[model samples]
Target: MGSVDKNPVPYCIVALMVVMMALSYGIQSADAQVITYRIHSDIFTELQDRYPEHAEDYWSSVKKAIRDGINAWIEVNPDLVVTPSHDERHNLLIEWIDSERVWGVEYHDRSLGYRIGIDFDSPEPDEYGASLLNPDIIKYVVAHEMGHVLGMGHSSDENHLMHGVENPKPKNIFDSKGYVVPHLSITDYRNIGGTQLDVSFHLQGYNVHDVAVVDINGTQYLVASTGNEGLHVLDMSNPDQPGLMDMDDSPSTDVWPLEGQPHIVQMYSDGFRVWSLSDPANIILLETVSHNSILDATLIYVDDTPLLVMVSKGLIQQYDLSDPHDARKSGAHHDNFNLLGVEDIHGVVRDSGSTYVLVDATFDGIQPYLIQPDKNPARVWHSFDQVEYYDHIQRIIEIDGSTYRITSTHDQIELYSVKPKIEPSDEDPETELIGHLLGYTVLGVDILEVGDSVYAVVATGPDGILGIHVGDKGAGKWTVG
Candidate 1:
């Protein structure tokens, strides 16, 4: 007995319209989609236990509650349509249970739902019933499950309905007190409208762990390796779902897309592979240069003069990719020279028009490596130890003239501000640590930034993928879904 509420407040309507306009104008690739859900009752005892005489009335009320929650979320995000399904065209399935045997099950169709199985015939009061029967809990469950149907995974943030557990602390949705929580927070609305403008994506598999983005011209590509599947390329003419372009059997760890050229230079475990994508479907392989001890190539940068900087395991190698079709290794240098002591490098970004490189270091420690590419040592970068120890550095972006780095460690996300340092004597300056932003314990992150805001696609354990908004320069944070 699932129902849906059609009418919503005017403020919610305005917010949804704004969100849709932003998505349509900002992100030109994919269309904003919606989802519908349906709840079914399995056994008669299940309803009878809860409402002895007025089972039908109670069922309708429960359905209405679920509908209200769904409508609330939709009012905030018009792009996310939540409606009730009368037939089989539903995105999610809900079932009321009467026993523990059917506690959790993953259906074959990849469609997931929740089961409220209870022992109605038992003489004793059901402990699980007490928690599940709560109106707020019931509504929360509907919202949480609908989150999955809407493509939101799970999240470690306790405040999120997608947080796996049936009931999370701070009982109320709005605040610590038991108040009626709105579907989307202010920060959430802003993020959905902001981050979609930037076209950036992260790729991970095998030893290939890295992030990359297609620049303004739709021709240039930039990538940074995080010690796994170096930097790889995908054809993005179809921006909604880009496909891998470089099919080289060798493991390419990092890549940097060259401006004014139809080719992207990538670093593989064995060497460097330059690819020409004028014909994106069938990529033309240009050249491959071999390296002796280069275990992984983390990042690559090419200047106006066409000098290439490739950051690899314990070293940063520079190359000459000016010839697009014919790339050659020119220079190579090691950072923290000793291979045994060097930490894994995650992100590397060269400040626009500057010779220095902003490197995000993780696993070894949360420190900023400011590298002066002109110096002989190239290790002249200052190391800041302000950020706590984290295992992985996921993404880094330059927003509002400030550099922000995101790291994944132990089950949490840490954000840091990078400020450039200027010394009177030296031409190259050092980057100072400004502050830390919001943190959350989540499985993985797919983050992007557009204009002044940041959005993260977080992987919640059983909850699924959730889109979260971490405000400008750590100003504020909230869950959008």
Candidate 2:
């Protein structure tokens, strides 16, 4: 019932309840580390003075891009906290290194931690200068520097965020083929342990909006938004060679593959469509859940049974998909929580048993609700305020005996482990809370646990996505290694 804010500062205090436990348990800390980032105030001030006509717009655009880049980097590694001041305990600082050329650099101290410096100059009224003001370019620069702070070294892989400046082709944050590759690699997380890694990959070709992964017949499929008219399906069997699968007028807004089933459920601007994919090479249409106002649907997940949960346009809808060929809506709810008075529902995640739903309450923070399938009216079990500025929750998995959630928002990826609330009356539930962080500003995320490791697939940009692996953690804290 309480409103949430976009900044997530309020929730930080509440989240401290869990974060403190995590810190006390030895979650790696970026403490007593002095990181200083000197920004060239003169360059920006000069740009504002010279381009008085469009300087404000240009500066605002670049700042937005930098914010995007920072968000993208955070989606991959949520542990590295970035602050402006040169604090001994802070991990990263954004500094202005040059004023004329407009270049930025990130310096990491093995002893002190991470530091980043950015340079921006007045454009020469040339195409390159104009491009420098472009949002995507600015985002790239911030992402690049953040990568250095996260302990990632420069990479030759052109698609990677750590790729050097010599090759500067902006990667689309979202590509129709599937989730875009992220900037950080498996090795990056291995080096940082449980700390966050700031890295991202560029998306090339296609203005991608959203992405979802579905597994059909042992093969993984990457479903994404293509243009404004249709959906693009990519075979992710091989991470490198991603190809497309064709679908008709169904411009998919979201996709969810029913676990243990051969059908993939897709939400489009027009309505909802089900595809029979028993045969991976060929996907056949099964059913459609049409709603006139279904302009856009963002997130989808499967509950304990065969129910499909979807969030779109500030509303939540549940569908029954017991029969792969037939899908029908069972119930729905509208979320009206907002601090900025903006009606936007960004992300959602379901518990393993599908008995509960964790939703981003936007500016109001994250709220947890208990799902009562049989009850006529759904009930709220417990709702907590000030969880985090969670744009997207990627993966929720139970590692060892604890459940953890991976969340992305505002240039950082955070891992939250559920702490049981002991009650005097009822028995404590056995469920665990686990989620993943992804998206340009940490819009969405998905994660899975295999063997002793956890793999997180995150949306880092409009077409940017990254896969991260967190190795086994002892009883203390969850570490990346």
Candidate 3:
């Protein structure tokens, strides 16, 4: 076990194994002096186990917790600006280790790397294992450890986050007691990161989901999802000031338009609804295609036949929308596991020749299928552990030869050379990270290419419409999202 928890806070006998440090010599004392250190926490089983359930905000919350903890220390000292370590020689690396006796072992020095061996699934009669899931408690633990990194000592105050059982042990209360329901401790940390960009249009705090540059007739329009506001169409004919074109009450989880047909396919509960865009002024609902709570659907024209690939409930089905009303089932892979997730299908992509299809979702990572001549889908590849490592694979977009996957956690966009690995491998494809999209939360993204410029209209929950103009290469232009 580490030293007693330092810097405690408001509590009612909430048992927690908090920030206990084992410091080395030469580190500066955090005595009324501001200190900054780059810190990085590794993702382990303790946090990964909860990823699927909290897929929407899990990774983002982890990012927020560490950053917020640093902010709390800054509150104690005005000059502090401890941030995530990029390439700093002297920084903190909060990591995990194989331990059997203790929840964690904190080893520190004035040197480059100080370790935080986070232990998961403690032995019998230990509830600390589960408490690690709570972000509120995580904040306190992080803040307390941060104090040690900044050169602070143990405090006897039970209200401070830096309080525990050892060191300045005045009176031991709930010494061996574990498990704590951490209250939401509002810290004074206010670093929103440089990712947050200002937007001209006001969203009124609505989490923007889908932002597609719709093509109606010959002009370009923007159809955005405003949470419970169904869908909002904006006249982007004049790119400078986009005017609201129309609004509907279908409240879609995902939406895609039919090729050259002023019609859109919107995924609703238990099915999908077709809305016509013939009159940009009035987006009319044409029909409903009910098939086991359609979680997600995408439009793709196979040769001359307009086809739709949808995942709902526990089945992957393809329908021929060539005749609109009399849509026929063309292909299907009857399986409950490759179906819709807690939300809808995160993303869908198909090969240019339409030979194969790739799908992604919340709990499920990414799955690839081979299109057969009999119109039956065959599983080509799948690996939930690999995909979930980054968080939920909510939406995937294929550009050039690489596939871009956007997850709900921290709104991260990862690019992968997925062609060669269409077949399941011993390991997942090595993905290239395109950095994280700046937003409190995100939903889906559609890749837009205009001449030589490639931009993505991302659906952010709180940050509104974010336009990411990704370059042909490098760390693309990330404005918001």
Candidate 4:
């Protein structure tokens, strides 16, 4: 038997044994930061062995106990996010064992990671016969064991959740939904990391791929494209309290709103479509263009004419949208810049009566092109210094006669100074790195200017939408708020 003092978050009633294996639980990454746990099959088998007829009832009760146990810690500190994994490999494992000594045990093995065992068949000598099988008792025991997983130990107060023994009638730590209501001490607060304003508000959906915000008649509307849920239009007049105004049943993978117009370009797996958001309450599809392998598309304006740029495979094709009902292909650029896996079209920039298109070539880096009404897009510059990184969306702006581009890439939001070279000049256009804000899976970025401050509202995959302080006017400094 090994000592229990050395294991991480150990609260074992029996002798602890050390095993040789790597732990997979509690592994935090740039994309995901939640602790994952899996339920062992033996837990259900144990219930089936004891109560053959009411096995389903016992099975559901046990699973709820485990979930409520994890929720207890989250109620105390929301930063300690926990979710169940159906996969065999996970951070923590819950199981049932045949034992009469302890109600539950929280222990760790080097190879198997952390695990909690509940002795459901144990019989107490008092009025509580086989009380360990009681749902309320099981809930209390699970919560107590889960506390150990959060680095908590036995509390001297018998009324506390971390108390060693399970009470016959435990404290009302459960709600009407059978979820744990946490009761934490000052020590618990000091021991755990509390939640931050990382996530402002989240609308539950399935595989949301892209989003675009536009204002129609002084009312802001958000158009989101999802993998399985199709399109959703939400009223964003209230930033914190957005309401789902309407939805379209056509599946889309990306979206871009046409500025100053009540139209939106939605990209599908095989083609692109244009939808009219004139009435946010009723989103109507206007036109559809079917091709194949369309990765991303954006609407840009050249010489006051609306043009749609679509990147398919490795080809950058242009379609003139002069007639809102009819989209005509004008020109296409199939160069050898090796842009087969173009991840995104970072919109366009209008400077000195010239329009420039920016693209995120996953393999070749950021590529800039000078586009004209009836001519092929000419490559102005290729950014190789910031190469080999998967860059996403970008927002361009001109501040004090200087052009700046803010782009989201991999796990960070980057800022660059874009200076287009004048014609007849031998020098190429210069793009210099300005600054970056470290983030996680930044999928979309939108800049909002309020008074003297500019903020980057970024949609980070699982981390939610983060509003970062880009910088104040003339401050020339960026910070994460």
Winning candidate number (TM-score): 4
Each candidate structure's TM-score, on Cα atoms with residue i matched to residue i, is 0.38, 0.46, 0.46, 0.49
Ranking by TM-score: 4, 3, 2, 1
Give the per-residue lDDT of model 4 (tens digit) for 96-141.
6444444344455643456776654332211211243344444445
| Cand. 2 TM to true fold | 0.46
Q: Rate the local accuracy (lDDT) of all candidates.
A: 0.44, 0.47, 0.52, 0.59
Residues 275-331 of candidate 1: C-alpha lDDT, one tens digit per residue: 776665456788877766654343334445455544555666566667876665566
Tell me the lDDT of model 3 at 111: 68
Query: Native-vs-model 1 lDDT?
Result: 0.44
* Model 4 lDDT, residue 252, Cα: 71
- State the lDDT of candidate 2 residue by residue for 1-481, as single tens digits: 1111111111112111111100011222323222343333443675666677877776666556656666663454344333444344443434345433323333345533444444444332121212333454445555555544433334443445444433333443311121122343212111121234433333335545455666664456665554364666666544445666665554655566666676667766567788876665677888877776553343334434566655445566666777767665667776554322323344443433444555454565544444444322143645434233234445556666766666654545666666655785434333432333222344345553333445555544343555555445454666686
- Per-residue accuracy of model 3 over 266-324 as CA lDDT, tens digit each: 76566776777777888877778776656666665556666677766667778777655
| Candidate 2, residue 338: lDDT | 32
Model 4 residue pairs with clashes: 21-110, 21-111, 25-91
What RMSD value applies to candidate 3? Answer: 13.9
Of 2 and 3, the candidate ahead on lDDT is: 3
Which model, 1 or 2, shows the larger lDDT?
Answer: 2
Candidate 4 runs further than 4 Å off: 1-206, 334-369, 379-392, 396-406, 414-439, 447-456, 462-481
